[model samples]
Target chain A: MKKFAIGFYVAVTIALMIWGYYQAIYVAPDEQTMHEAQRIFYYHVPSAMVAFLFFAISLIGSIGFLSFRRNRPDWAQASDAWALAGAEVGVVFCTVVLITGPLWGRRAWGIWWTWDARLTTTLVLWLIYVSYLLLRRFAAGPQVQTLAAVLGIFGALDVPIVYMSNRWWRTQHPAPVFGGGDDSGIKDPTMLAAFGWNVLAWLAWGLLILGLRYAVERQHQKYAAQEAQEALNEVA
Target chain B: MTSALWTHLVKDLRIEWRSREAINSMLFFALLVVVLFSLAFDPRGAFSQEIAGGVLCVATMFASVSALNQAWAREIRHQVLDAQRMAPTSGAELFLAKVLANFLFVSIVQLLLAPVFLVFYNLRVEGNAWLLAVVLPLGTWALVANGTFFAALSIRTRNRELLLPLILFPIFMPALLAMVLATTSILTGDNDPTLWIKLLAGYDIIFTTVSLLLFDVVLHAE
Candidate 1:
């Protein structure tokens, strides 16, 4: 079943990618201002959405780990695995967002970087999760789990504040062009179709990657437990 | 509960008063920071007033971290924390007491540093003095609340001095940003200081409440 699922995911991903490419290139209308360069938004926005989705998952996992770890070790392990997987996958997509954002900006705004509110907040968000991963790496033993969990909660809580501060700090970047209230939106159905297809494809890709990463985490945990048991047996 | 809180607060204050280690070092460190800032840039230059708020806030934050590190290190080194843990007092009481002690220490340092900053930076406040008065305590309380909590969190970690700041600075960014903007507005005579003050107070309330509730989980973690 697992192998079948993997095959199905790969097939769907390939099919969607083919359709997305066709739609982006042949079907979508040229953006009024940015022309061809604006197409990067199709990939950039979805990556950001996926990163946020994974961070939310990590937050849930952190909360679950903290609340249940004392009474239910199995649940504790599962939560820890989920958190580790979520962070790893979240960082991957955040990196994509960081990269694609600059590429799009350079084409549209004629600059590689600006301290725009959304950009600044995204940078900070990236830094917070990076630090979260570092804390997990440096703080060893059973204590690391609880410490990382606490940090995770704090990091997630800070997201809203970061967004608010940035929004109020300054407005250097352009406002959202989609769902940006009634004033903005894509009128071209073909452009919307292209964007929609790419978003669905990227979301599926993100989940597939998350599943593989989660499996790796669980296997690693099992191996570590086995090694500890063997060491104890040898000592006895 | 009040008695327990008072006892812990007094115990911490008594220790500091006897040794004068944390407060003295923090004060001297802050002075050195100001001096370094003055040396790094010409105080009479156009940049002085514009950057002074940032400089003051950064210096205070670094010194507060040192003070907070000392606060926890002494207790951990002497096993005082372990003893306190074994005591019947609740975690919230102990946490509040520590936060209060740290808050007082940080506030005093800020008070001393403000005048020195004004003298060295060759700057004047154009806004109401009352605004400065309001910004200082709210800002200090926000810093100390998180500082105390993160200090405790990093206590058991290796290389805690490094770890505490790494964990803290990013988390404290929003509060620090608000405080800096508020201070700058007061110095530059920006017409409205209301928004920045509200941000600082809101940050203080949110973190203090969250820390109070979650501190016990941190304390009892294995």
Candidate 2:
């Protein structure tokens, strides 16, 4: 049942992504300041949302690991795999946010980059998760896994601080107003619909990737256990 | 109850006094950081309160890191943590003792640096220097409290010296930010000290409480 649901979800997600891309190209707003290339927001935003979700999942897994021992490795591993999957997609999206943000900034704000809150925080978060993955490479065994889980939990704690820091710093150093309308930046109803669909599509893709990754991890664990058993038999 | 706490505390202090290399190295490194900052920046630029804010921020981070590493290094090197765990004291007592030791150790460095920082930076401490008195103790408590916890956990790892900062810094950023802002304001004579002070108090309370709660699971993980 879980597999069926995941498969259906994957199928619908791929369909939605195709639709999202088509809509983005044909129906979405033509960038007044950023040219047609600014349509990358649909993909970029969804990827970021998924990435954040992954971090959240990683935190939840860490909490579980900390709370329950010996009986929770399966759940822990599943969560770990999903978190890693989400991070993988997130990095891709962060790349998109990074590449497109500067372009948008140059076109709209007339600067390549301003070290604004969102950009800086997002970049820092990207570096952080990248390190989180690197740390996992050195961490092995149940003990190390739990330790990495603790690190993952603490690392995700930075997300809120990063966001708040950005908000505080941005307000402290206000940027000059370039665009005429309200700066909340959510202007159109159609744009909102497209954005919502884009988010949905990206979330579906994120789950799909995580499901695949979990299966692979389970197989790896199985092989590892088999190898250990064979080694024990040889010793006997 | 109070005697039990004090007993554990005295024991830790005695243990630390026996091997004082960690504290000595930490003090040296922290002062060196400030001197490096002074040399790296032009003297006029370095002495100003604005630059002092940045230096103070970096100083606390370095001091905290040094003390944390030392605190854990002693435990791991001596293989004393497990024995310490097997002692009559609870994990809570152990945690509190370590954090207090960390607090004392870092505060000693802070005390040493204060006079030098004051003279070098020409800091006046005009509005409520009492606030500085309150902030340093509380600020160092928060920094060292969290640092000691992370350090304890990191010591169990293969490469503690590297992993400790990666684990501690991000979690401690909020406290560090509040400390820097509060210290900066006090140094720079910013009038609105209310919010930043409250933030420092809040950070100290929240981190200390959380670390104490999690100390058992963290220590016994091995």
Candidate 3:
């Protein structure tokens, strides 16, 4: 029954993804200024949004693991899984934002990259999480969870500083083009619809992958625990 | 300082003073970086002032990694970590002491490197000379405090040395930017570095507090 439900969810997510692609590529009007290259913004902005969301989720999970590690070992293990899954999936989406941003910027700004507020913060965010993943890979034993949790909190703490420092640099940064929080540059209704659909679709897709990653981590943890138990039994 | 912190700090200083190994290597490594950067970037006139801040910060960063790699190795060996835990002291004391010890060593290296750096870059402090005192130590504390914590985190890994910088540099980026920019402004007298200086101080406070709160958790992890 669970398999059937997950399979159905995956199918629906794939359908939403195709619909989103159609909305972005065919339904949205061509941008007078940037033309087809502007379409990359549909993917780029949503990916950035989703990436930040998952990273936040990962931060919360890390906190959960740290708080629960002693009394609620099982809960801690599950939280660690969510933490890893969020970071892994978040990195995947952030990578998309980094690449697609450059491609779009090359057409829109006549340059491949610049050390502007948006670009610099996103790049540093990607770097911080990538190092988080690397620490997970390199650190050994049961302590890996503990250390990675500590690093997670550290990485999250750096993001605001990264954003603030770049803004203070006083360089000529072009203002962010999309979803700048309160004052969005996106004005057209058609463009807004396409962007909305893409955000929904990409978010759905990211969550699906995040769930799978979490499940895999849980399975691995269980197997490792069982192996340890069997080794103790052998000693007995 | 608390007795435990003071004790740890004094012990680290004595051990380091005996051999001076970390200081010697850090000074030589930093000197090499300055010369090589000069060779590569050709620090001439105003350009020297422009690049010197970045060069000095990067030099300190690279030189500190070797010392940080050894920061926890001694504790983990011969069951020293376990023994330390049995003592009636919080791990935060040990962590702060280590950070303090490492901070002093790196500053000594920076002081020694100042003459060599000035000569190689043909540099002058254009902004505020007194601020160099403020900027360099704040930057060093940021690097060593985080470096010591992350170093402990990576000690049991296979490539413990390689892992330290890989983890440190990325989170260290914003601080690096502030340090480099502040130093550049001081040297070039182009921009007001008050903002960057504030940013560095804030960064140090936040990261240091978090590190202290979490140190014992890391120290006792299975």
Which candidate achieves the best DockQ against the true structure?
A: 3
Pairs clashing within candidate 1 = none
User: What does DockQ come to for candidate 3?
Assistant: 0.82
Model 1 residue B132 distance off true place after TM-score fit, in angstroms: 1.1
User: Best candidate, TM-score-wise?
Assistant: 3
Positional deviation of residue A211's Cα in model 1 after best superposition, in angstroms:
1.3
In order, candidate lDDTs are 0.86, 0.71, 0.91
Off by over 4 Å in 2: A1-15, A31-38, A70-73, A83-99, A112-124, A172-189, A234-236, B1-8, B45-47
Runs of candidate 1 exceeding 4 Å displacement: A234-236
How well does candidate 1 match the true structure in TM-score terms?
0.95
Tens digits of per-residue lDDT for model 1, B80-122: 8888788887898988999999889888888888878878887
Residue B52, candidate 2: C-alpha displacement in angstroms: 0.4
Candidate 1, TM-score of its B chain: 0.96
Judge candidate 2 at residue B99 and give its lDDT: 78
Ranking by lDDT: 3, 1, 2
Q: Between prediction 1 and prediction 2, which has the larger lDDT?
A: 1
What does candidate 3's lDDT look like per residue over B1-222, in tens digits? 499999899999999989898899999999999889988988788888889999999999999999988878878779887898888889999999999999999999999999988888788887889999999999999999999998987886766888999999999999999999999998888888898899999999999999999999888888
Per-residue lDDT for B144-171 in model 2, tens only? 8878888887777777778777767666
